[model samples]
Target: MNNIDTRNPELEGLAKCPTGIRGLDEITDGGLPAGRPTLVVGGPGCGKTMLAVEFLVRGATVYDEPGVFVAFEETAGDLAKNVASLGFDLNGLIAQKKMVIDHVHIDPAEIEETGEYDLEGLFIRLGHAIDSIGAKRVALDTIEVLFSGFMDHAVLRAELRRLFSWLKEKEVTAIITGEAGETTFSRYGLEEYVADCVIALDNRVVNQIATRRLRIVKYRGSAHGMDEYPFLIDADGFSVIPVTTLGLDHEVSSERVSSGIKDLDAMLGGGYYRGSSILVSGIAGTGKTSMAASFVNAACARNERCLYFAFEESEGQMIRNMRSIGIDLGPWIESGLLQIHASRPTVHGLEMHLAMMHKLVSEFQPDVVVVDPISNLISVGNGLQVRSMLTRLIDFLKSNQITALFNDLTQGGGAMQSTEVRVSSLMDTWLLLGYVEENCERNRVLSLLKSRGMAHSNQMRELILSDDGIHLTEVYAGTGGVLTGLNRLTGEAKTNAAEMRQTQDLDAGARAVRRRREALKATIAALRAEYESELDELDASIARERAQQIALEDDCSMDER
Candidate 1:
């Protein structure tokens, strides 16, 4: 046998086939190895058959490459009905000659183990199905019945190995499913070692909740995410959510969107970036929803589409609740500028929720997406899972240049930290909301916890909700803390009173100085008048003296004559 070069295809330029599964194609680097058999082993109800059926179905539907599915355990009709709920008309595809489904029923009791029995019959059936449609893809779902039907294990293993190699020789990409063994991944321990790629599916219950996951156990020539990823089986089909994207290569936007509250937007450095993720975390009854409503209104006012993922309340209830605060989301909803999707967080697993968001985002193509009370997702998933989902969400939104706003409902009365601690670090901006008590009354407080790229105010503003909408009041900090509510009014009163008194004193002192200046001016004017009169008299006396001297000179001249 020639030594084969088995390296990651991503680096070796080996071709790959796209699975067309939502995130599965991305996770597997590009999908399974092209024209090679991939072994899918998992426990019952783990979606082995579904995965195989989807592989062939997508190959024919999306790739335009015809496929054949050979069922060893299920009949063609049963297989068709099973995936019909997923909207896959396997029978219709068969009628169109785009796909072929062959059922190979093998009975162990009817077969005699005296002769040399290879998988010639199985090969003939698979070949006929493939040749019927000129298929480039084939699926042998759950190959464990072959072992139960065949008595010789050695002959079965040899035939299985030959079967995989022969499919590769025919250049048809095939999928082989098997029951999971306790120690080995497959029952016969023969498929995994022979196939070019191996994938494991799992459906486990944790904390009374079921989570379906998929993982790539082995790949002959491709680099893939080996971590167990969350997958969802919804009406659309199987969708895998990769934990997160590779790097921060997503595009950033310089455009800013208003936060709805004018003063609050001013504090956020002219609002959030277009493609950034925002976390509005706060304790209950602290205007978190009001803030989110303001953002939605602003987005709709811009004529940009916005999606509101409401987890706490229904659409009508949320509209009514927001109306109480003077935010008329009803008009926007009617106008179709805003879409509010209200679903209970407990309705599905976290992965399913993520998948829903992804689907809506893709369909709506909204400029902004709002997930109200993201903290509620924690009840279904652990911290790591939530973080992973958030990371992926943020990456997707950023990549699409779509703004995502997440509202986190804190647990305790002022437990802002516990709500979005894991997601806070991933968010582009974190707005913390809390309550301040003064004069035996509660007041809503808003403060910026962090902002990644822009300069934001560090001061906490008093969040005032009224019929006019949310208003952010300038907060004054005294020795106690940020003065709010009645305290703020009292502080403003005292400050105004002090300023008035100081102005009054300054005015009184100015009057006194003006009086003194007028008196001094009068005295200087009188003194100048007196000095002028005295100088005039002295000049007259000098003139008279000169006259007398002239007269004496004239007398002397007459005597001389």
Candidate 2:
């Protein structure tokens, strides 16, 4: 049989392997160095094997790069079955002669090292498998197993050097996975000096919260990210997300899109900019999803295609439930104006979710995208990973000029407080919804927390969902308080009671004033009559005096006349 040419001169200038993992390639500046051995050193259960397997599988499926998997720990069958849940058909690939899986079972109890033991047998087997299928990628999972089975450390080290030289000679991009020790990184104690690239994976638990971290310790002759990045492992596989290093060169758009609610649109100074990301954060049952759905419906009504990614609820269930709130997604779906992609947060890795979303966005070419309750996704990964994932997602949407809406569920008495602390700075517009207890009953209130590059109403508006659809009524500002929910009605009643008391006080004062005025008028009339009677009596007395004195006054009167 003609020996396959394993030597590749292009390996010196080879591009990084894309890995086909969303957000990960961006962090690694494309992918791991091509045609070179990279050491993946990690503790137990840190996803070393999973990452290697995924790399090989992605190469096989996505990039059409045939690969070989050499497992020193588990049998080839077990590896295949374990990853079957992730939708990888390793056995089929092997059967099709496109891939090779070599199980290297080396039991320490069976080893009788009378002389120098060389890994020449293992190398021969690897060459046979690779030559069989012309494989371009190879993975040796947990090389530490071979070292642990042998007590001859010097021989193992010498053999490891030869193995690396042989792999370089083979010219296939190789990944060597080794178990991490308690203090040192690799169990073999050879990772630091032999590998062209070193990658470390760590899993840590603090306060009942488990977090996975990945770091590129060293990469020879190439610039690489040095910071520890966050990652997640789910149904699909491992995904690494590096935090964004924001640059001023990001694309910007001045185009605007309509808010689903007319009044809310008016409040937003026209509407949100096209491609701008809006965050709707609120407590449980605060209608965040309803608001997002209303916007999606509005977009659909405008004949603009939209995608809704529901993490907490199934598409069918969401459709059925939202119908009661006046949002009928079924018609939109049937008309192809709306598409709902619903999946659990843990159903797949964050990278897988992002890749699926990227694919959907490309295929649908939607004008709007909605992620209902992004906080549920936050639960699947660490803080750094979640933040990085969101940043990349937002950047992708912004670059594409796709209007994106994200919902975040808030917890505790100050539900949105944590969200504000964590994610508010990343959002272009922040909408807050919550329960307000003003009266004896509770009510729902919606408010615009902030809107960048646009003026927005600071007042809290009451959101009402009737048969007509979602409605935002005028903000109620009265003596009691602003209208929230049932409490607003109670506040209105209290305000009315206070106003009635004031009215009754004014009526009592008017009655007292009328009584005093009537008493004064009667007294004046009586005084006037008494004065007239006295005047008449005085006139009669004067007349009688005049008559008696007439005889005497005749002569005086004649004289006076």
Candidate 3:
């Protein structure tokens, strides 16, 4: 054989068909093996049929490849009606000759044991369906139903092999669904027949919460993701979340976004970095939500879209509460710059919550997202589960270059520095909000625990909330400890009083020194006046002596002149 490049089969006549479903093609390395039979095994209600149908629908609508869907369990009408909620117009596609759905209804009670059983009839029917629409894709929903009437494993295996062979000969990409078994991938162990690619879907419930997951079991000629991915099925249809996207290869931005609190921003070295995950953790009533709201407000003020996920409060309650702190989010909401999604943590499983968040983020395309109180997510999952969910979430947000702020409620009487979810390392900036007890009073304080790639203040600032907004005040650290609230106010008051007394004493002493200087000046002026009078008398005595001697000193006066 000529030198073949087995590593890259796509370039060597092994092309892959794109699924067009969001995130599915990425994990599959470009969807299923083209013109090959791929097995999809899943339990009941685990979305095996849905995945198969979406594959055909996307192929037909997006790739312009007509497809045929052969249903073994449900009728064409039922399948169409079931998928109608997902906006897949099966009837419309059938009318337009883009798709053909042939429901092969099989009743085990009506079947008779035959000497030799085969899928020759199925081949004729499927071949006609494909030729009718020139279909390039085919989906057999629940292959187990077709073979339920046959008890001979030899006949079943032979027929399955023949079926896959026929599809390959026709050069049509196909997906075969089978009921998942307890010990095998399928009840009949169909994984042996369809060896090109295999996918397993599961619907697992833990602690009364349900989550759908998808895993690529094997791909013969391709390098695909091996990790199990969480997928969501809603009105929008299938969305496979690829865990591979959580890698550390995501791009970073040097831009920064404000936190709305000026002093807090100053302490954070101007603001939080754009595309960074920020964690605002604190105890109850310690203004965690307030800080989150302030960040949202700042984002909205910058005319950037913001999404707020509130787990504890309703939208109205959050709006009202934020308005009290001078951060009115109503305008942003009305102006379409903000969206608040409020729900309880018990509403959905951690994976479901993550899926919903992914959906909303994709739809809204917000520049900034805030999740108030991620601690509540712990109610639905354990610590490890919550951390995994958060890690994926943070990774997703960072990959999109979206600034995400998460508020965590740290339990009181525990380590105040740690978070309940235990994902602090995932955050690029961590702001801890807490309260200090001083003088029998509780005062809120905000501290910067960590800020990556910048210089940040380490001092704890008192968190002050007023009608104007949230403010951070410099806290006093004395010999006793950090003084806050009433204690700091009292200390400042005493210091001011002492300074006032000292200033008054200094003013009084300066006044006494001025009075003494004035008395000395008066004494010196009296002494100078007396000296001038004595000098005048001495000049007069000199003049009289000169006049008495004038006659005898006439010649001397002339000489002196």
Instruction: For each candidate, give its TM-score against the true structure.
Output: 0.88, 0.68, 0.86
lDDT of each: 0.86, 0.81, 0.89
Tens digit of lDDT per residue, candidate 3, span 236-331? 789887755545877988887899999988888789999999999998999988898899999999999999999999999999999999989999
- For all predictions, the C-alpha RMSD in Å is 4.0, 10.3, 4.3
Model 2, 218-316: lDDT tens digits are 777667788888677756677676665434355777777888888889889888888889999998887888889889988998899999999888888
Q: Tell me how far the alpha carbon of residue 439 in candidate 2 is from the true structure, in angstroms, after superposition.
A: 7.2
For 1-561, candidate 1 gives per-residue lDDT tens digits of 223444344456667888887788988999888888889888899998888888888998999989988899989999999999999999889999999988888888898878776789888878888888899998888787888888898888888888889998988988889888888988879554555789989998776667888999988777889899888887788988786635789888888999888898899879999999999888778887888899999999999999999998899998998988788999999998899999888888877888788889889999989998888887788888778877888888888999889998777844557554367888889898888887998998888989989999989888899988999888878655679999888988888998999999999999999999999999999999999999999999999999999999999999999
Backbone clash numbers for all candidates listed: 1, 2, 0
TM-score of 1: 0.88
In model 2, pairs of residues that clash are 439-487, 443-485
Q: What TM-score number comes out for model 2?
A: 0.68
Q: Local error of candidate 1 at 389, Å? A: 2.2
The local distance difference test score of model 3 is 0.89
lDDT of candidate 2?
A: 0.81
Better of 2 and 3 by lDDT: 3
Q: Which candidate order results from sorting by TM-score in descending order?
A: 1, 3, 2
